[model samples]
Target chain A: MNQIDGKSARALLLILSTFTYLLFGAMVFDKLESEEDTRVRDEIERITDRLKNKYNFSERDMHLFEAIAIKSIPQQAGYQWQFAGAFYFATVVITTVGYGHSAPSTSAGKLFCMVFALFGIPMGLVMFQSIGERVNTFIAYSLHKFRDSLHQQGFTCLQEVTPTHLLMVSLSIGFMVIVSGTYMFHTIEKWSIFDAYYFCMITFSTIGFGDLVPLQQADALQAKPLYVFATIMFILVGLAVFSACVNLLVLGFMASNADEVTAANREPPSAIVLERFARNSLVESQLFNIQKHSTVGVLPGRPRRMYSIVPNSAGDVHLRRRSTRRSIQDTVCCGCFKPRPPRYRFSLTRRPTNISHLVDLELY
Target chain B: MNQIDGKSARALLLILSTFTYLLFGAMVFDKLESEEDTRVRDEIERITDRLKNKYNFSERDMHLFEAIAIKSIPQQAGYQWQFAGAFYFATVVITTVGYGHSAPSTSAGKLFCMVFALFGIPMGLVMFQSIGERVNTFIAYSLHKFRDSLHQQGFTCLQEVTPTHLLMVSLSIGFMVIVSGTYMFHTIEKWSIFDAYYFCMITFSTIGFGDLVPLQQADALQAKPLYVFATIMFILVGLAVFSACVNLLVLGFMASNADEVTAANREPPSAIVLERFARNSLVESQLFNIQKHSTVGVLPGRPRRMYSIVPNSAGDVHLRRRSTRRSIQDTVCCGCFKPRPPRYRFSLTRRPTNISHLVDLELY
Candidate 1:
C-alpha cells in the first residue's frame, strides 16, 4: 500500500476499534441499568408488602437489609469504568499486599471478580510482554557494548569483572536511600519506622493499600505543593532504582550467554535429539550383537561387506562385516547424521590420513 | 554435592527465605500500628478540643467523622489482608462489574492501595512466569507426541492449522461456557443477567468483590451441603476452563518463532566465527563505499578503523549481520548450506595427436 493510504487506513482502524469498544460498553451499561432498576423496584415492593402483612420490623433490621441490597447495585451496573478499575485492581491483588479495606463481599460480586480476573490477568500479561520485549532489547544492546568494552580491557567474561559485585554495590546504595527516605518520612509525618517502611513498600508497589496515609496536617497546611512534589519525586526515583536493579539482574543472566542469543528469537534445541541419540545407540548395539551371533549361519549368496566397523563392541569381525553390508543398503541416518558416501576407493584411501595431512591436502 | 545433601540444602534455603520474609513483614506491621495509633489519638483529641471551644456540632456529623475514623482504624489493623483483598478487588474492578459497595476510602487505606500494587504486580508476574514455564514444557511435550502420532498418519505442520484459528476455536468454546454459566446462575439466584454476568466475571477473576452475594433462604434451611457443593463445582469448572484457555493460547504462540527465544537455554556457537563473518560482510556491503575526495577513505589497513565505522549508515546491516551470523554459528548446519562441489574440472593437456583423436581428463 502507498504510505498515505496506509496511514489513513491505520488511523481509520484505530478509530473504528475504539468506537466499537465504546459502543459495546454503552450497550452493556444500558442493559445493566434497565435490569438492575427492575430488580430493585421488585425487591423494594416485596419488602414493603411483607412489612404491611407481618409485625413491624425494627429500624436496625430494616437498615441491615437495605445496606445489603444497596451494596448489590454496583455489581448490576456492568459499566466499563468499573471493569477498567477492577482490571487494574487484580494485578495488585495477586502480588499479596492485601490492602483489604476494599473488596467485593456479595456472592455475585465475588463471582464476577473471579471471572473478570481470569481473563483480565492474561490480557495484562500480553501488555507486560510487549513492554518487556522493548526493555529486554534495550538491555541486550547495552550489555553487548559493555562486553565489547570489557573485552578491550582483556576480560573474558563480564562476570569475571564482578558484575554481580557491582550490582550488589548498587543495591546497597538503593537500600540506603530507601531506608533514609523512610526515616525522613517517619520524622516529618510522625509515623513509626514500621509505618514508614510500610508506606514505602506500598507506595513502591503502587498497591496503595491506604491503611496508613501520611496525614501531616501542619506540613500540608504550610506546603501542600511541596509535599505533593516530594512524594511524586520519591516514588519516581524509587521506581527508577527498582527498574535498574531488575535490568541489571536480567542483563547479568543474559551476559552469561551473551554470545549465543539475541534478546529476541533465542530458542533452545529440542530434548528429542538427545533422547533419539541414546535410543539409537542402544538399538545399534543390540543389532550388532544379533549380527555377531547369526553371522556363521549366513548363506553363501550374500558376501560380507568390509565397510562396517563397530567400535567398542564384542561382536565378531565377520558378523560386523555382514551387518555393515545390510546396513549400507537398508539404513537411513536421522538427525545430525548423514549417510556415508558409497564405498569409494578415493575416500577409503583418504580416511586414514592424520589431521595435519588433511589440512595440508586441503590447503594445497 | 551428594543428592540427599543437596535436597536438604534446598529445603533449608527455602525455609530461610520464608522466615526472612515473615520477620521483615512483622517489623513493618509493628511500625504501622504504633504510628497509626499515635496519629488517631492526636486527631481525636484535637477534634474534640475544637468541638468544646467552637459552636456545638450536631450529633450526626460528629458521629460520621467518628465512624469514618473508626472505620479507618480497622483498615490499618487488617492492612495486609485488606491489601490482598484490594489487589483482588482491583482485578474485579478493571474487568468491570465493580461490585463497588466495598472499597478503600481512608487516606491511609488509599495510600496503601497505591503502594502495594506497584511491587505486587511484578511479584504476580514472577508467579505467572513460573507457572508458564511448567505449562509450556508440558504443552511442548504433548505437541511433540501429537505430531508424532500425526506423522504416522502422514501429516506435517498440521498444515493450514494456524495458531490464530486454534485461538478462535478455544475462545468460542470459552465464551459459550461463560455465557451459559452466567445464564444458569441468573435463573437459579433470581438475579438479573447483568448481575449474573458480573458474578461470573468476579468469580473467574478471583476478585470476590462481595457486593451482590447469593442468598438462598430455602437452601439455608435445607441442603446446605448441596449448595456448597454447587459453589465448589462452579469454581472448579471455571478455573479448569480458564486454565485450559491459557495453556492452549500459550502453546499456540509457542508453536511459532516468538516462543523460541523465551525458551530455556542451550549452548551456542563460538563468538570468533560470528565476529569474523560480520567483519567480512561489512567490508563487502555496498554502503561501505567512500569517495577519494571524502574526509575518510574505505581502503584497508586504515588507522581510523573505529572512527570510520562511527558515522556508519550501515549500523542496521552491522547489527543484523552480527545477530544472524551468531545464530547460524550456534545452530548445527545440518547440510542446509553445504556448498556444491564443482561438477566438472578441466585438465590442461599438451598433445601431438590430430584434432579427431581428442583426450578427456577429470581433475578432482
Candidate 2:
C-alpha cells in the first residue's frame, strides 16, 4: 500500500475501533444503569409530588424554588470565588479535572476561563509530561542502581532494568495514591469506603463526574485548608504518576507495533529502506558479533577508508570514523557524539538502544 | 550540572511555574467572580427565605426539598442511562469531559465505570492521536501539493509549506469548529451566544464544568437523535483539531529548545557526542557544500576508504554507502532508509529533518 494511504487506513482503523468501543460501552451502560436510572426517576417524582402536596406550593413557585436550590449548592461551600476555592478551581481547570461543583457564573469569568485554558492546558500538559518522564527515568535509574547493588552483593540473578520494571513501579505508586486518597476522603467526608474509592478513581482518571465532589460539604473549601491542600496534592501527584504509566505504555505500544510491522511483508518502502539502513549501519559499525549472520562487503577505492565498529566494555557499539590523513589517536567515536542532552524529552527516544533517527542538521 | 540534577531542577522549575500560575489565576478569579458570586448567594438567600415564610415549611423539610430538587434535575432530563444518553455518557467518559449531567449511582455501575475508563481512556487517547497526526500530515501534504501546483503555474511567490502554515491552518479549523458549535447550541438550545461559546471552549478543553452542559434540557439526549449526534461529533472533532494544533506547538517548542541548547556551552556530553557524530556522518558523506566552514582531514592508514556525502537534486542530503565488492548500481541512499514507515508516529520524529536517533538493534 502507498504510504499516505496506509497512514490514512490506520487512522480509519482506529476510528472504527473507537466507535465500536463506544457502542459496546453504551450497550453495557444502558444495561447496568437503565434500571437504576428508572428507579431514581420514579423516586424523584414521588418525593417532589409529596413535597408539593405537603407544602401546597404553586407549580410556578416550586419551579422557582428548584432553580434557587440548585444555584445555592455551590454557595453552601462558602465563598467559592475566594482565594482557596479559586485556587482549587484553577487547579481543576489546568488539570482538566473540572468537577463542576462550582463554576463561574459571570460571562467575564467564563471568558477568562476560556483564555486561561487556552494557554494553561498546553502548559499543564508539557509540565506534567516532563515531570512524568523524569519520574520514569528516576525509577529506571533507581532500579539500575538496585540491580548493581544486588550484583555487588553476589546476586547475579537480577536482569537489567527494563521499561516493564519502570511501568510496574509507577503503577504501584499510582495504586498507593488512589488507596490513600480513598482513605483520606472517606475519613473526612464521611463517605462509605466504596464510595470514596469510586471518587478517587473518578478524580484520578479525570472523569470527575462531580457526582461526589470533595470539599463541598460543611464549607470544607473555606474551613479546612489542610484537607484542601492535601486534595490538590493528591490530584497533581496522581496525574503525574498516571502520566508516567502512560509514557511507558506509549513506548511499549510503539515497540510492539514496530515488531509487528517487521514481521509483515506489507511494509512501507521508506520503513524497509530505513530498517535496512539501520541494519547496515549496525553491521558497518560492527556493533555486535554478527558476521556469521550476515555478509558485509568493503567498498573498494584507491583512497579507501575502513571504519572499524567495535563494542566497548559496556556492550555499547562504538563506530570509529577516521579521515585518511588523521592518526588513529585522532579518530572520533560516532556513537557518543550527541549534540546535547535533550531539553524536551519524550520517553520514546530517551532510551539509548532505540536510536534510529537521523540527526537534525538544522540543530547541528 | 549532573544529568540527574539537571533533570530534577527542570522538573522543579516547571512545578514552581505552575504553582505561580495557579496563584495568579486564583487572584484574577477572585477579582472577577467574587462580586457576582456574593450577589447570587444573597439573592438565593432572599428568595429562599421568602419562600419559607410563605410556605411555612420547617427547616428540615426545606433541606429535604433542596436535596430533592438537586436530585430531580437529572431526572427531569428523562432516563439518562437509556441508549442515547448512555452513548453520550460513554463519549464524555473516554474524552474525560465528565459533564456530570448524569453519573452512575449504583455501586456496580460505578465499579464498571472505573474499569471501563481504565481501558477506554487510553484507547480514546491513541485513537484521537492517530487521527490528529494523520489530519496534520494530510494538511501538510495538501499544502505541499498546492504550492507545487502554484509553482508550476509560474507562481513562484508561494513558498514550501512550513510548520507555521500547518499550525495556522489547524488553529483556524479549530476556531471554525468552536464558532459553528456556538452557533448550533445558541440556536437549538436557546443559550446566549457567549454562553454557547463558553460551553464549547470548556467542553473542548475537557474541563467540562458541567454548569452549562448541552442536551440536558428538553430531554434532548433521548428526544433529538440528530442533535445528539451533532453534539457528539462536535466534541470528537473539536478534540482532534486541538490535538493537531498541540502536535505542531510541541514540535515547534522542541525545535526552539534544541536551538537554545545548541547556542549554550553548558550542554550534556551525550548530546554533544551525538551531535558531533551526526555532523561527522554528514561530512563523511559530503552531504553539503560546507567544506569552507570546516577543515577536512584524511587519516593516515592502509585499506583506506573515503565516503562521499552528496546533496540530491531535491536538496535532501543522501549518504551513498557503496561497498567495493559491488558496482555503483548497488549504492544505497542512507537518507531514505526509514525502517517501515513508523506505525506509532509521534509528530516529533516524523519529519525527515529531525532524525538523530540511533537505530534499535533489537528491532533490527
Candidate 3:
C-alpha cells in the first residue's frame, strides 16, 4: 500500500477498534449502573464500612480505599478524549507499552480483553515486524561500509557472531546510555536512584504504567521544558538503540548455523571417521546373519531401502533414507541394533540385497 | 532446571514481580493521599464536575463519567489487596486479558507502564519459549511409538509436513470439543450468543477480564459444584489445546530442507525467488568488494579474486565481483531475457561469509 493509504487504513482500523471498545465500555458502564450492580456495590461498601469501623482504619487507609473506589467509576467525557485515551491504551497494551494506569476489572472484561488480544496482539506484532524489517534493511545497508572496513582489518567470522554476543554489545551501549540519561534525569527531576532507574526501565519497556510518570507533577516547574525535551530525546534515542539491538539479535539468531559452516570449513572429516563407520557395519552384519535363520514368519517387504552403510575404514554408520514408496518404514535402523529386545524375528523368503533387509534382523 | 525448581522459580518470579508492582501502587497511593495529591485530585474533580454540569449529562453520561473517574483514582485499599488486584491486572495485561474496567489516567502512569512492559513482555516470552521447548520434547517422545506404528503402515513426508496443516487438524478436533462444551456452558449459564462467544474467547485466551465472569454470579445453590467443575475443565482442556497448537505451529515453521536428502531434489526457482537471490548476491558482492578494496588500500597489496558476471543476453545486465587480486565479470540475463539499467552501485566490505544472506532478501 502507498504510505497515505497504509496510514489511512491504520487510522480506520484504529477508529473502528476504538469504537468497538467504547461500545463495550459503554455497555459495561450501563450494566454496572443497573439496580443489581448498585445493590452489589452497596452491599460491598456496607461490608467494607463495617469492617473499617470494627477495625478502626487509619486516615491513610481510608484515603487509599476512597481513592480506589473513586477510580473504579467510569467517567463521562467527550468521545474524543475518551477514545484517544482508550486507543492509546490499546496501542500501549498490544505494543507492550502496558502503562498500568488503566486495566480491566470484571471477569467478563478480562475475558473480552484476552479475546481482543488474540487478534490484536498479532496485528500489533505485524506492525512492529514491518517497521523492524525496514529498519534492519537500512542498518544493514549503512553498516555495510563499516563492516567492509573491519573486513580489511582482518576481522573474520563477523557474520558468524552469536545473538547473545550481539545482545551484550548493544546492551552495553544501551546500559551506558540509560545510566547517563538516568543520572541526568535525576539531576533534572530530582528523583531517587531507584525511582530514576525504575522510570527508565518502565519507559524503555513501554509499560508506561503511569504510576511514575516524568514531567507530569507540579514540583519540577522550573525544569519542565528541559525535562520534557530530555524525556523525548531519551525515548527516541533509546528506541533507536533498542531497535538496532533487535535487528542485530534477529540476524544473529537467523545466522545461528554460521558457526557450523565455519567449523566444517576448518576441519574436514578424517579417515578415522571412516574407520568408525566400518566398525558399526560389522556389528550390523553379524546381527543380519542371526536374523536369516529366525523362526518367526517374515513381515511384508518394504518397497524402498531403509538404511545404507557405506563401507569405510573406520566402520559403517547407518544412513537412513527417505521412503518414497507406500508402506515403507520411514525409519531406516537395522533390526539388530533396535534399542528394544526382539522376541520374534521375521524370516524373509529371499535374502534381499537392498538395505531394506537390514530391517529383518532380529535382536536376541 | 528440575520440574520442581522450574515451577518454584516461576512462582517466585510471579510473586516478586507482583510485589514490585504492589510497592509502586502503595507509593502512588501514598502520594495521592498527601495534601498535594488531594489538591490535584480536587482540581481534576472540579474540572470534571464543571464539564458534567455544563454539558447537563444524561444518566448514561453520568454513569460513563463516574466509571472513568473511579478508574482515574490511584488506590482503594491496603497494600495487600492493592497488591493482589495489581498482580491480577499485571497477569491479565501480559496474558492479554485486558478487562478494561481499570486503566491509567495520568501521563506518568501511562509512561511508567510502557517501561514496565518492555522487560516484562520479553521475560514472559522467554519463559513461554522454554516451556514450549519442554512440552515439544515430551510430545515428540510420547508420539514416537505411535508415529512408528504409522510408519510401519507406510507414511512419508510426515516429518516434513507443515505445522499449519497439523494445526488445522487439531483445530478441527478442538472445534468439536469447544462446540459441545460451549453448548453445555450456554445451557448452564443461559448467556446470549455474544456473551457466550465472549466468555469462550476470554477463557480460551486466559485474559479472564472478569467483566462477564462465569459462575461467580450464578445462583448460590448451583454455583458451588458447577463452578468448580467448569474451572477444572477449563484449566485442563485449555492448557492441552493451547500447548497442542503451539507445538504444531512450531513444527510447521521449522526448515524442511534438512530432511530432503535427494541430489535431484532441487526445485526450480520461481521468478520472484531468482530475483531475490540475485539481489542478495549483488548486495553481498558489493559489500565484499568494498571491504576487500578498503583492506587492500590499507595493506598496499593483497591477493583477492573478484567473482564477476557480464550479461550474455541483450539488455544492460552486468554482473561483477571484484577483489584485490582479481575481478570477474559475466553477462547476466533476467528471467524474461530482458536487460535493465543499473540503479546504483554501492559496495559493502568485511561482511561475514558464513552468514546466510538470503534471509535479508525479501521474497514478498
Q: Which candidate number maximizes lDDT?
A: 2
Listing every candidate in turn, what is its Cα RMSD in Å to the true structure after a full C-alpha superposition?
Answer: 22.4, 13.4, 23.9
Query: Which DockQ value does candidate 1 get?
Result: 0.04
Deviation in Å, model 2, residue A216 alpha carbon: 0.8
Worst 10 residues of 2 chain A by lDDT: A293-302
| Candidate with maximal DockQ | 2
Candidate 3 chain B least-lDDT 10 residues? B339-348
Compared with the true structure, what per-residue lDDT tens digits does model 1 show for residues A1-364?
5322443354355435433433343343333333433453455456455542453535654344334333322222222113222322333333222233334434444454454345444543333333333333333334445655887899866532123433454466557768977987898788877668766765444434344434224434224546544654465456445544554553333322222212121112211111111222232544433332222111111113312334333222212233434443332221111221211112222223322232223323
* Fnat of candidates, each listed: 0.03, 0.62, 0.03
Which of the numbered candidates is closest to the native, going by highest TM-score?
A: 2
Ordered by DockQ, highest first, the candidates read: 2, 1, 3
Weakest lDDT window of 10 consecutive positions for candidate 2 chain B: B291-300
C-alpha lDDT of residue B173 in model 3? 53
Q: Give model 2 RMSD, 1 decimal.
A: 13.4
DockQ of each: 0.04, 0.30, 0.04
- Give the C-alpha interface root-mean-square deviation per candidate: 18.5, 14.1, 23.4
Q: Is the docking of candidate 2 incorrect, acceptable, medium or high quality?
A: acceptable
Which digits, one per residue and each the tens of the lDDT, describe model 2 over residues B97-187?
A: 9999989988888988999898899888878767776767666656656776887899977554445566688899999999999999999
